[model samples]
Target: MKRISNLLIAFVAIEHILFLIMEMFLWQTPFVIQRFNMTEQIAKDSALLAMNQGLYNGFLAAGLIWSLLIRSYVEQAFKIKLFFLSCVVIAGIFGALTVKISILVIQALPALIGLVVVYLSKPQENYDVVI
Candidate 1:
Protein backbone atom coordinates (compact mmCIF):
# COMPACT_ATOMS: atom_id res chain seq x y z
CA MET A 1 0.00 0.00 0.00
CA LYS A 2 2.84 2.37 0.79
CA ARG A 3 4.51 1.60 -2.48
CA ILE A 4 1.29 2.06 -4.38
CA SER A 5 0.64 5.34 -2.63
CA ASN A 6 4.12 6.58 -3.40
CA LEU A 7 3.74 5.60 -7.04
CA LEU A 8 0.46 7.48 -7.30
CA ILE A 9 2.01 10.54 -5.71
CA ALA A 10 4.90 10.36 -8.11
CA PHE A 11 2.50 10.05 -11.00
CA VAL A 12 0.65 13.19 -9.93
CA ALA A 13 3.94 15.05 -9.53
CA ILE A 14 5.09 14.03 -12.97
CA GLU A 15 1.79 15.06 -14.49
CA HIS A 16 2.17 18.51 -12.97
CA ILE A 17 5.71 18.76 -14.30
CA LEU A 18 4.39 18.05 -17.76
CA PHE A 19 1.69 20.64 -17.24
CA LEU A 20 4.39 23.13 -16.26
CA ILE A 21 6.27 22.41 -19.44
CA MET A 22 3.20 22.64 -21.63
CA GLU A 23 1.77 25.79 -20.11
CA MET A 24 5.04 27.63 -19.62
CA PHE A 25 7.26 26.58 -22.49
CA LEU A 26 4.92 25.15 -25.10
CA TRP A 27 1.80 27.26 -24.80
CA GLN A 28 2.27 28.57 -28.33
CA THR A 29 3.18 25.30 -29.95
CA PRO A 30 0.79 23.59 -32.34
CA PHE A 31 0.67 20.47 -30.16
CA VAL A 32 -0.28 22.41 -27.05
CA ILE A 33 -2.75 24.53 -28.98
CA GLN A 34 -4.47 21.40 -30.30
CA ARG A 35 -4.32 19.62 -26.97
CA PHE A 36 -5.88 22.59 -25.19
CA ASN A 37 -8.33 23.19 -28.00
CA MET A 38 -7.26 26.81 -28.27
CA THR A 39 -6.92 28.93 -31.36
CA GLU A 40 -3.54 30.38 -32.07
CA GLN A 41 -4.85 33.83 -31.33
CA ILE A 42 -6.25 32.70 -27.98
CA ALA A 43 -3.03 30.92 -27.11
CA LYS A 44 -1.03 33.97 -27.92
CA ASP A 45 -3.33 36.18 -25.96
CA SER A 46 -3.18 33.96 -22.91
CA ALA A 47 0.48 33.05 -23.03
CA LEU A 48 1.48 35.13 -20.02
CA LEU A 49 -1.40 33.86 -17.92
CA ALA A 50 -0.59 30.31 -18.91
CA MET A 51 3.03 30.81 -17.89
CA ASN A 52 1.95 32.05 -14.48
CA GLN A 53 -0.38 29.08 -14.09
CA GLY A 54 2.43 26.81 -15.15
CA LEU A 55 4.72 28.24 -12.49
CA TYR A 56 2.11 27.33 -9.91
CA ASN A 57 2.00 23.83 -11.30
CA GLY A 58 5.74 23.63 -10.96
CA PHE A 59 5.41 24.62 -7.32
CA LEU A 60 2.89 21.85 -6.77
CA ALA A 61 5.28 19.37 -8.33
CA ALA A 62 8.08 20.65 -6.13
CA GLY A 63 6.00 20.26 -2.99
CA LEU A 64 5.10 16.69 -3.85
CA ILE A 65 8.72 15.86 -4.54
CA TRP A 66 9.71 17.42 -1.23
CA SER A 67 7.17 15.26 0.54
CA LEU A 68 8.65 12.16 -1.06
CA LEU A 69 12.11 13.09 0.14
CA ILE A 70 11.24 13.22 3.85
CA ARG A 71 11.73 9.55 4.54
CA SER A 72 13.02 9.72 8.09
CA TYR A 73 10.11 11.58 9.63
CA VAL A 74 7.06 9.53 8.84
CA GLU A 75 4.49 11.79 10.45
CA GLN A 76 5.95 14.89 8.89
CA ALA A 77 6.10 13.22 5.52
CA PHE A 78 2.47 12.14 5.79
CA LYS A 79 1.39 15.64 6.72
CA ILE A 80 3.30 17.14 3.83
CA LYS A 81 1.84 14.69 1.38
CA LEU A 82 -1.68 15.28 2.70
CA PHE A 83 -1.36 19.03 2.36
CA PHE A 84 -0.02 18.92 -1.18
CA LEU A 85 -2.49 16.28 -2.33
CA SER A 86 -5.36 18.26 -0.88
CA CYS A 87 -4.10 21.34 -2.68
CA VAL A 88 -3.98 19.44 -5.94
CA VAL A 89 -7.51 18.14 -5.46
CA ILE A 90 -8.86 21.57 -4.65
CA ALA A 91 -7.00 23.17 -7.54
CA GLY A 92 -8.28 20.54 -9.92
CA ILE A 93 -11.85 21.06 -8.75
CA PHE A 94 -11.50 24.80 -9.18
CA GLY A 95 -10.00 24.42 -12.63
CA ALA A 96 -12.83 22.12 -13.62
CA LEU A 97 -15.41 24.61 -12.41
CA THR A 98 -13.77 27.58 -14.06
CA VAL A 99 -12.07 26.16 -17.15
CA LYS A 100 -12.85 22.55 -18.12
CA ILE A 101 -14.50 19.50 -16.64
CA SER A 102 -11.73 17.26 -17.83
CA ILE A 103 -9.53 18.85 -15.18
CA LEU A 104 -11.48 16.95 -12.55
CA VAL A 105 -10.62 13.58 -13.99
CA ILE A 106 -7.14 14.46 -15.21
CA GLN A 107 -5.84 16.31 -12.17
CA ALA A 108 -8.02 15.72 -9.13
CA LEU A 109 -8.96 12.08 -9.45
CA PRO A 110 -5.46 10.65 -9.21
CA ALA A 111 -4.51 12.87 -6.31
CA LEU A 112 -7.74 11.98 -4.55
CA ILE A 113 -6.96 8.31 -5.01
CA GLY A 114 -3.41 8.89 -3.84
CA LEU A 115 -4.64 10.69 -0.77
CA VAL A 116 -6.82 7.73 0.12
CA VAL A 117 -4.04 5.26 -0.49
CA VAL A 118 -1.62 7.26 1.59
CA TYR A 119 -4.07 7.48 4.43
CA LEU A 120 -4.72 3.79 4.27
CA SER A 121 -1.04 3.02 4.27
CA LYS A 122 -0.36 4.94 7.43
CA PRO A 123 0.51 2.93 10.50
CA GLN A 124 -2.47 2.29 12.73
CA GLU A 125 -0.81 4.05 15.65
CA ASN A 126 -0.20 7.14 13.59
CA TYR A 127 -3.89 7.90 13.32
CA ASP A 128 -3.79 9.97 16.46
CA VAL A 129 -0.92 12.05 15.18
CA VAL A 130 -2.72 12.68 11.90
CA ILE A 131 -5.90 13.70 13.63
Candidate 2:
Protein backbone atom coordinates (compact mmCIF):
# COMPACT_ATOMS: atom_id res chain seq x y z
CA MET A 1 0.00 0.00 0.00
CA LYS A 2 2.82 2.40 0.80
CA ARG A 3 4.49 1.63 -2.51
CA ILE A 4 1.25 2.10 -4.39
CA SER A 5 0.62 5.37 -2.60
CA ASN A 6 4.08 6.62 -3.41
CA LEU A 7 3.67 5.67 -7.06
CA LEU A 8 0.42 7.56 -7.24
CA ILE A 9 1.99 10.60 -5.64
CA ALA A 10 4.85 10.44 -8.10
CA PHE A 11 2.40 10.15 -10.94
CA VAL A 12 0.63 13.31 -9.80
CA ALA A 13 3.92 15.14 -9.43
CA ILE A 14 4.98 14.12 -12.91
CA GLU A 15 1.66 15.23 -14.32
CA HIS A 16 2.17 18.65 -12.78
CA ILE A 17 5.68 18.84 -14.13
CA LEU A 18 4.32 18.15 -17.59
CA PHE A 19 1.70 20.81 -17.05
CA LEU A 20 4.42 23.25 -16.06
CA ILE A 21 6.29 22.55 -19.27
CA MET A 22 3.22 22.86 -21.41
CA GLU A 23 1.98 26.07 -19.82
CA MET A 24 5.28 27.82 -19.35
CA PHE A 25 7.31 26.80 -22.37
CA LEU A 26 4.90 25.48 -24.94
CA TRP A 27 1.86 27.63 -24.56
CA GLN A 28 2.36 29.18 -27.98
CA THR A 29 3.15 26.02 -29.85
CA PRO A 30 0.73 24.66 -32.42
CA PHE A 31 0.05 21.55 -30.36
CA VAL A 32 -0.70 23.55 -27.25
CA ILE A 33 -2.86 25.95 -29.20
CA GLN A 34 -4.86 23.07 -30.61
CA ARG A 35 -5.04 21.31 -27.28
CA PHE A 36 -6.20 24.46 -25.48
CA ASN A 37 -8.47 25.49 -28.34
CA MET A 38 -6.97 28.96 -28.29
CA THR A 39 -6.22 31.32 -31.13
CA GLU A 40 -2.63 32.33 -31.67
CA GLN A 41 -3.36 35.84 -30.56
CA ILE A 42 -4.95 34.64 -27.35
CA ALA A 43 -2.08 32.32 -26.64
CA LYS A 44 0.38 35.10 -27.20
CA ASP A 45 -1.57 37.52 -25.04
CA SER A 46 -2.02 35.04 -22.19
CA ALA A 47 1.43 33.50 -22.24
CA LEU A 48 2.64 35.36 -19.17
CA LEU A 49 -0.37 34.36 -17.12
CA ALA A 50 0.03 30.79 -18.24
CA MET A 51 3.67 30.92 -17.21
CA ASN A 52 2.69 32.05 -13.75
CA GLN A 53 0.16 29.28 -13.46
CA GLY A 54 2.77 26.84 -14.63
CA LEU A 55 5.13 28.04 -11.95
CA TYR A 56 2.53 27.28 -9.33
CA ASN A 57 2.13 23.78 -10.76
CA GLY A 58 5.87 23.37 -10.52
CA PHE A 59 5.71 24.31 -6.86
CA LEU A 60 3.08 21.66 -6.26
CA ALA A 61 5.23 19.09 -7.96
CA ALA A 62 8.20 20.20 -5.91
CA GLY A 63 6.31 19.81 -2.68
CA LEU A 64 5.19 16.28 -3.57
CA ILE A 65 8.72 15.36 -4.58
CA TRP A 66 10.04 16.82 -1.35
CA SER A 67 7.64 14.68 0.61
CA LEU A 68 8.92 11.60 -1.19
CA LEU A 69 12.46 12.49 -0.21
CA ILE A 70 11.71 12.55 3.51
CA ARG A 71 12.13 8.82 4.04
CA SER A 72 13.35 8.85 7.61
CA TYR A 73 10.22 10.42 9.13
CA VAL A 74 7.04 8.68 8.10
CA GLU A 75 4.71 11.07 9.89
CA GLN A 76 6.37 14.10 8.34
CA ALA A 77 6.13 12.51 4.92
CA PHE A 78 2.46 11.67 5.41
CA LYS A 79 1.65 15.22 6.38
CA ILE A 80 3.53 16.72 3.46
CA LYS A 81 1.99 14.34 0.95
CA LEU A 82 -1.47 14.95 2.34
CA PHE A 83 -1.09 18.70 2.10
CA PHE A 84 0.19 18.73 -1.47
CA LEU A 85 -2.33 16.17 -2.67
CA SER A 86 -5.13 18.21 -1.15
CA CYS A 87 -3.83 21.30 -2.89
CA VAL A 88 -3.78 19.49 -6.22
CA VAL A 89 -7.31 18.24 -5.75
CA ILE A 90 -8.56 21.71 -4.84
CA ALA A 91 -6.73 23.34 -7.71
CA GLY A 92 -8.14 20.80 -10.11
CA ILE A 93 -11.66 21.37 -8.87
CA PHE A 94 -11.28 25.12 -9.12
CA GLY A 95 -9.87 24.89 -12.62
CA ALA A 96 -12.71 22.65 -13.62
CA LEU A 97 -15.27 25.07 -12.25
CA THR A 98 -13.70 28.17 -13.75
CA VAL A 99 -12.15 26.92 -16.95
CA LYS A 100 -13.33 23.47 -18.05
CA ILE A 101 -15.01 20.40 -16.63
CA SER A 102 -12.27 18.24 -18.05
CA ILE A 103 -9.93 19.55 -15.40
CA LEU A 104 -11.84 17.59 -12.82
CA VAL A 105 -11.11 14.32 -14.57
CA ILE A 106 -7.67 15.22 -15.77
CA GLN A 107 -6.17 16.90 -12.73
CA ALA A 108 -8.33 16.21 -9.71
CA LEU A 109 -9.29 12.59 -9.99
CA PRO A 110 -5.81 11.11 -9.77
CA ALA A 111 -4.82 13.33 -6.89
CA LEU A 112 -8.00 12.52 -5.07
CA ILE A 113 -7.33 8.83 -5.47
CA GLY A 114 -3.74 9.34 -4.40
CA LEU A 115 -4.84 11.29 -1.35
CA VAL A 116 -7.14 8.50 -0.28
CA VAL A 117 -4.54 5.86 -0.88
CA VAL A 118 -1.95 7.81 1.07
CA TYR A 119 -4.32 8.19 3.97
CA LEU A 120 -5.12 4.51 3.97
CA SER A 121 -1.44 3.63 3.77
CA LYS A 122 -0.50 5.66 6.85
CA PRO A 123 1.28 3.82 9.65
CA GLN A 124 -1.18 2.27 12.08
CA GLU A 125 0.32 4.05 15.08
CA ASN A 126 -0.16 7.42 13.40
CA TYR A 127 -3.91 6.85 13.13
CA ASP A 128 -4.34 8.37 16.60
CA VAL A 129 -3.49 11.80 15.17
CA VAL A 130 -5.89 13.60 12.89
CA ILE A 131 -4.78 14.13 9.34
Candidate 3:
Protein backbone atom coordinates (compact mmCIF):
# COMPACT_ATOMS: atom_id res chain seq x y z
CA MET A 1 0.00 0.00 0.00
CA LYS A 2 2.80 2.36 0.92
CA ARG A 3 4.60 1.49 -2.28
CA ILE A 4 1.49 2.29 -4.26
CA SER A 5 1.15 5.61 -2.51
CA ASN A 6 4.70 6.51 -3.28
CA LEU A 7 4.21 5.66 -6.92
CA LEU A 8 1.03 7.67 -7.10
CA ILE A 9 2.68 10.66 -5.54
CA ALA A 10 5.54 10.38 -7.99
CA PHE A 11 3.11 10.07 -10.85
CA VAL A 12 1.39 13.27 -9.80
CA ALA A 13 4.71 15.02 -9.60
CA ILE A 14 5.62 13.90 -13.09
CA GLU A 15 2.27 14.91 -14.46
CA HIS A 16 2.58 18.38 -13.04
CA ILE A 17 6.07 18.68 -14.42
CA LEU A 18 4.70 17.85 -17.84
CA PHE A 19 2.02 20.44 -17.31
CA LEU A 20 4.70 22.96 -16.59
CA ILE A 21 6.45 22.15 -19.80
CA MET A 22 3.31 22.20 -21.86
CA GLU A 23 2.03 25.47 -20.53
CA MET A 24 5.36 27.21 -20.37
CA PHE A 25 6.85 26.13 -23.66
CA LEU A 26 4.22 24.56 -25.85
CA TRP A 27 1.13 26.59 -25.23
CA GLN A 28 0.97 27.84 -28.78
CA THR A 29 1.41 24.56 -30.55
CA PRO A 30 -1.48 22.97 -32.42
CA PHE A 31 -1.42 19.92 -30.12
CA VAL A 32 -1.45 22.02 -27.00
CA ILE A 33 -4.15 24.20 -28.51
CA GLN A 34 -6.29 21.12 -29.12
CA ARG A 35 -5.71 19.89 -25.58
CA PHE A 36 -7.18 23.09 -24.21
CA ASN A 37 -9.68 23.48 -27.06
CA MET A 38 -8.54 27.00 -27.74
CA THR A 39 -8.01 28.68 -31.09
CA GLU A 40 -4.53 29.66 -32.23
CA GLN A 41 -5.18 33.33 -31.59
CA ILE A 42 -6.65 32.59 -28.18
CA ALA A 43 -3.66 30.46 -27.33
CA LYS A 44 -1.42 33.30 -28.36
CA ASP A 45 -3.30 35.78 -26.24
CA SER A 46 -3.17 33.49 -23.22
CA ALA A 47 0.48 32.51 -23.52
CA LEU A 48 1.67 34.67 -20.65
CA LEU A 49 -1.10 33.52 -18.37
CA ALA A 50 -0.36 29.94 -19.23
CA MET A 51 3.29 30.45 -18.46
CA ASN A 52 2.41 31.85 -15.08
CA GLN A 53 0.23 28.84 -14.42
CA GLY A 54 3.06 26.61 -15.55
CA LEU A 55 5.39 28.17 -13.03
CA TYR A 56 2.91 27.31 -10.32
CA ASN A 57 2.77 23.74 -11.56
CA GLY A 58 6.55 23.57 -11.40
CA PHE A 59 6.39 24.71 -7.80
CA LEU A 60 3.93 21.94 -7.02
CA ALA A 61 6.27 19.37 -8.52
CA ALA A 62 9.13 20.73 -6.48
CA GLY A 63 7.12 20.43 -3.28
CA LEU A 64 6.24 16.83 -4.00
CA ILE A 65 9.87 16.02 -4.72
CA TRP A 66 10.91 17.75 -1.53
CA SER A 67 8.46 15.60 0.43
CA LEU A 68 9.91 12.44 -1.07
CA LEU A 69 13.43 13.38 -0.12
CA ILE A 70 12.48 13.70 3.54
CA ARG A 71 12.60 9.95 3.94
CA SER A 72 11.48 9.01 7.42
CA TYR A 73 8.60 7.31 9.10
CA VAL A 74 7.86 10.44 11.04
CA GLU A 75 4.86 12.67 11.59
CA GLN A 76 6.63 15.53 9.83
CA ALA A 77 7.03 13.46 6.70
CA PHE A 78 3.36 12.55 6.77
CA LYS A 79 2.41 16.17 7.21
CA ILE A 80 4.59 17.23 4.32
CA LYS A 81 3.09 14.65 2.01
CA LEU A 82 -0.43 15.53 3.03
CA PHE A 83 0.18 19.22 2.63
CA PHE A 84 1.59 19.04 -0.87
CA LEU A 85 -1.01 16.54 -2.03
CA SER A 86 -3.69 18.81 -0.63
CA CYS A 87 -2.21 21.72 -2.54
CA VAL A 88 -2.38 19.73 -5.73
CA VAL A 89 -5.95 18.70 -5.09
CA ILE A 90 -7.04 22.21 -4.26
CA ALA A 91 -5.32 23.71 -7.27
CA GLY A 92 -6.82 21.02 -9.45
CA ILE A 93 -10.30 21.73 -8.15
CA PHE A 94 -9.87 25.44 -8.68
CA GLY A 95 -8.62 24.89 -12.20
CA ALA A 96 -11.53 22.61 -12.91
CA LEU A 97 -14.02 25.12 -11.61
CA THR A 98 -12.59 28.06 -13.52
CA VAL A 99 -10.91 26.52 -16.54
CA LYS A 100 -11.99 23.03 -17.48
CA ILE A 101 -13.63 20.06 -15.85
CA SER A 102 -10.98 17.77 -17.20
CA ILE A 103 -8.56 19.39 -14.79
CA LEU A 104 -10.26 17.45 -12.01
CA VAL A 105 -9.56 14.13 -13.67
CA ILE A 106 -6.19 14.95 -15.18
CA GLN A 107 -4.71 16.85 -12.26
CA ALA A 108 -6.71 16.31 -9.09
CA LEU A 109 -7.78 12.69 -9.04
CA PRO A 110 -4.28 11.24 -8.65
CA ALA A 111 -3.51 13.66 -5.87
CA LEU A 112 -6.78 12.75 -4.16
CA ILE A 113 -5.84 9.08 -4.34
CA GLY A 114 -2.37 9.98 -3.14
CA LEU A 115 -3.89 11.76 -0.18
CA VAL A 116 -5.83 8.64 0.81
CA VAL A 117 -2.82 6.42 0.27
CA VAL A 118 -0.54 8.71 2.26
CA TYR A 119 -2.98 8.64 5.14
CA LEU A 120 -2.86 4.86 5.16
CA SER A 121 0.82 4.61 4.29
CA LYS A 122 2.10 5.21 7.76
CA PRO A 123 4.63 2.68 8.83
CA GLN A 124 3.98 0.13 11.54
CA GLU A 125 4.04 1.11 15.22
CA ASN A 126 7.46 -0.38 15.50
CA TYR A 127 8.74 2.27 13.17
CA ASP A 128 7.41 5.15 15.19
CA VAL A 129 9.82 7.08 17.34
CA VAL A 130 9.06 7.53 21.02
CA ILE A 131 11.20 10.56 21.58
Candidate 4:
Protein backbone atom coordinates (compact mmCIF):
# COMPACT_ATOMS: atom_id res chain seq x y z
CA MET A 1 0.00 0.00 0.00
CA LYS A 2 2.81 2.33 0.90
CA ARG A 3 4.52 1.50 -2.38
CA ILE A 4 1.34 2.20 -4.31
CA SER A 5 0.87 5.51 -2.54
CA ASN A 6 4.46 6.45 -3.17
CA LEU A 7 4.22 5.58 -6.84
CA LEU A 8 0.99 7.53 -7.21
CA ILE A 9 2.41 10.52 -5.43
CA ALA A 10 5.51 10.46 -7.59
CA PHE A 11 3.45 10.17 -10.74
CA VAL A 12 1.16 13.02 -9.77
CA ALA A 13 4.05 15.23 -8.77
CA ILE A 14 5.84 14.70 -12.06
CA GLU A 15 2.68 15.00 -14.09
CA HIS A 16 1.69 18.30 -12.50
CA ILE A 17 5.19 19.66 -12.93
CA LEU A 18 4.86 19.10 -16.65
CA PHE A 19 1.42 20.65 -16.57
CA LEU A 20 2.85 23.67 -14.80
CA ILE A 21 5.40 24.15 -17.55
CA MET A 22 2.84 23.65 -20.27
CA GLU A 23 0.29 26.01 -18.79
CA MET A 24 2.76 28.69 -17.83
CA PHE A 25 5.42 28.56 -20.52
CA LEU A 26 4.02 26.68 -23.48
CA TRP A 27 0.40 27.65 -23.13
CA GLN A 28 0.37 29.71 -26.28
CA THR A 29 2.55 27.21 -28.10
CA PRO A 30 1.20 24.60 -30.45
CA PHE A 31 1.62 21.68 -28.09
CA VAL A 32 -0.95 22.69 -25.50
CA ILE A 33 -3.38 24.08 -28.08
CA GLN A 34 -3.30 20.82 -30.01
CA ARG A 35 -3.63 18.72 -26.85
CA PHE A 36 -6.20 20.64 -24.82
CA ASN A 37 -8.12 22.20 -27.73
CA MET A 38 -7.59 25.77 -26.67
CA THR A 39 -7.09 28.66 -29.03
CA GLU A 40 -3.63 30.19 -29.15
CA GLN A 41 -4.99 33.66 -28.58
CA ILE A 42 -6.88 32.60 -25.47
CA ALA A 43 -3.90 30.69 -24.17
CA LYS A 44 -1.68 33.68 -24.63
CA ASP A 45 -4.11 36.00 -22.94
CA SER A 46 -4.48 33.67 -19.98
CA ALA A 47 -0.84 32.90 -19.45
CA LEU A 48 -0.56 34.69 -16.13
CA LEU A 49 -3.74 33.14 -14.80
CA ALA A 50 -2.58 29.74 -15.93
CA MET A 51 0.71 30.32 -14.19
CA ASN A 52 -1.11 31.08 -10.97
CA GLN A 53 -3.14 27.92 -11.29
CA GLY A 54 0.04 26.00 -12.03
CA LEU A 55 1.50 27.26 -8.77
CA TYR A 56 -1.39 25.71 -6.89
CA ASN A 57 -0.73 22.43 -8.63
CA GLY A 58 2.90 22.72 -7.64
CA PHE A 59 1.81 23.22 -4.04
CA LEU A 60 -0.11 19.96 -4.19
CA ALA A 61 3.01 18.22 -5.42
CA ALA A 62 5.05 19.83 -2.68
CA GLY A 63 2.59 18.64 -0.06
CA LEU A 64 3.00 15.10 -1.28
CA ILE A 65 6.76 15.40 -1.01
CA TRP A 66 6.46 16.87 2.46
CA SER A 67 4.43 13.87 3.60
CA LEU A 68 7.32 11.69 2.50
CA LEU A 69 9.69 13.57 4.77
CA ILE A 70 10.30 12.42 8.34
CA ARG A 71 10.61 15.77 10.08
CA SER A 72 8.10 17.53 12.30
CA TYR A 73 4.91 18.93 10.68
CA VAL A 74 4.38 15.61 8.90
CA GLU A 75 0.76 15.83 9.92
CA GLN A 76 0.60 19.23 8.27
CA ALA A 77 1.61 17.49 5.07
CA PHE A 78 -1.52 15.38 5.08
CA LYS A 79 -3.59 18.42 5.93
CA ILE A 80 -2.21 20.25 2.95
CA LYS A 81 -2.90 17.34 0.63
CA LEU A 82 -6.40 16.96 1.94
CA PHE A 83 -7.11 20.65 1.58
CA PHE A 84 -5.88 20.86 -2.00
CA LEU A 85 -7.48 17.59 -2.99
CA SER A 86 -10.74 18.76 -1.56
CA CYS A 87 -10.49 21.90 -3.67
CA VAL A 88 -9.81 19.75 -6.72
CA VAL A 89 -12.83 17.62 -5.92
CA ILE A 90 -15.07 20.65 -5.75
CA ALA A 91 -13.57 22.08 -8.90
CA GLY A 92 -14.15 18.77 -10.62
CA ILE A 93 -17.77 18.88 -9.76
CA PHE A 94 -18.02 22.44 -11.02
CA GLY A 95 -16.25 21.48 -14.21
CA ALA A 96 -18.62 18.62 -14.71
CA LEU A 97 -21.53 20.99 -14.32
CA THR A 98 -20.23 23.92 -16.36
CA VAL A 99 -17.20 23.14 -18.47
CA LYS A 100 -16.74 19.49 -19.42
CA ILE A 101 -16.92 16.01 -17.98
CA SER A 102 -13.39 15.08 -19.01
CA ILE A 103 -11.74 17.49 -16.60
CA LEU A 104 -13.40 15.69 -13.72
CA VAL A 105 -11.87 12.40 -14.73
CA ILE A 106 -8.54 13.77 -15.88
CA GLN A 107 -7.91 16.24 -13.11
CA ALA A 108 -9.92 15.26 -10.08
CA LEU A 109 -10.14 11.48 -10.01
CA PRO A 110 -6.45 10.77 -9.55
CA ALA A 111 -6.22 13.49 -6.91
CA LEU A 112 -9.13 11.97 -5.05
CA ILE A 113 -7.55 8.53 -5.13
CA GLY A 114 -4.22 9.86 -3.97
CA LEU A 115 -5.86 11.75 -1.16
CA VAL A 116 -7.70 8.61 -0.06
CA VAL A 117 -4.49 6.65 0.05
CA VAL A 118 -2.69 9.31 2.03
CA TYR A 119 -5.57 9.58 4.43
CA LEU A 120 -5.75 5.84 4.98
CA SER A 121 -2.03 5.37 5.53
CA LYS A 122 -0.90 5.79 9.09
CA PRO A 123 1.59 8.58 9.64
CA GLN A 124 5.14 7.66 10.56
CA GLU A 125 5.76 9.05 14.01
CA ASN A 126 9.12 7.43 14.61
CA TYR A 127 11.79 10.08 14.88
CA ASP A 128 15.16 10.47 16.58
CA VAL A 129 15.73 13.44 18.87
CA VAL A 130 19.33 14.59 18.82
CA ILE A 131 20.62 16.12 22.01
The prediction achieving the highest TM-score against the true structure is 2
Query: What is candidate 3's lDDT per residue for 1-131, written digit by digit as tens?
Result: 87798898899999999999999999999999998789999999999999999999999999888888888645676677888899999999998999999989999999999998888877655544321
Instruction: Give lDDT tens digits, candidate 4, residues 17-126.
Output: 87678776777788877777788788878889888878877776676565556435666655665665666667667867876788788767877787688667646666
TM-score-wise, the better of 2 and 3 is 2
Candidate 1 lDDT by residue in tens digits, 1-131: 99999999999999999999999999999999998899999999999999999999999999999999999988888888999999999999999999999999999999999999988898555355442
Instruction: Report the alpha-carbon TM-score of model 2 versus the true structure.
Output: 0.96
Stretches off by above 4 angstroms in model 2 are 127-131
TM-score of 1: 0.94
Q: Which 10 residues in a row give candidate 4 its minimum summed lDDT? A: 122-131
Please tell me which model should have the higher lDDT, number 1 or number 3.
1
What C-alpha lDDT, on a 0 to 100 scale, does residue 101 get in candidate 2?
A: 95
TM-score (C-alpha, index-matched) for candidate 3:
0.90
Q: Candidate 2, overall lDDT? A: 0.95
Clashes of each: 0, 0, 0, 0
Model 1 score (lDDT): 0.93
Name the candidate that leads on lDDT: 2
Q: In model 1, how large is the Cα lDDT of residue 14?
A: 100
Q: Compose the digit string of candidate 2's lDDT tens values, residues 1-131.
A: 99999999999999999999999999999999999899999999999999999999999999999999999988889999999999999999999999989999999999999999999889766345455
Greater-lDDT candidate between 3 and 4: 3
lDDT of each: 0.93, 0.95, 0.88, 0.69
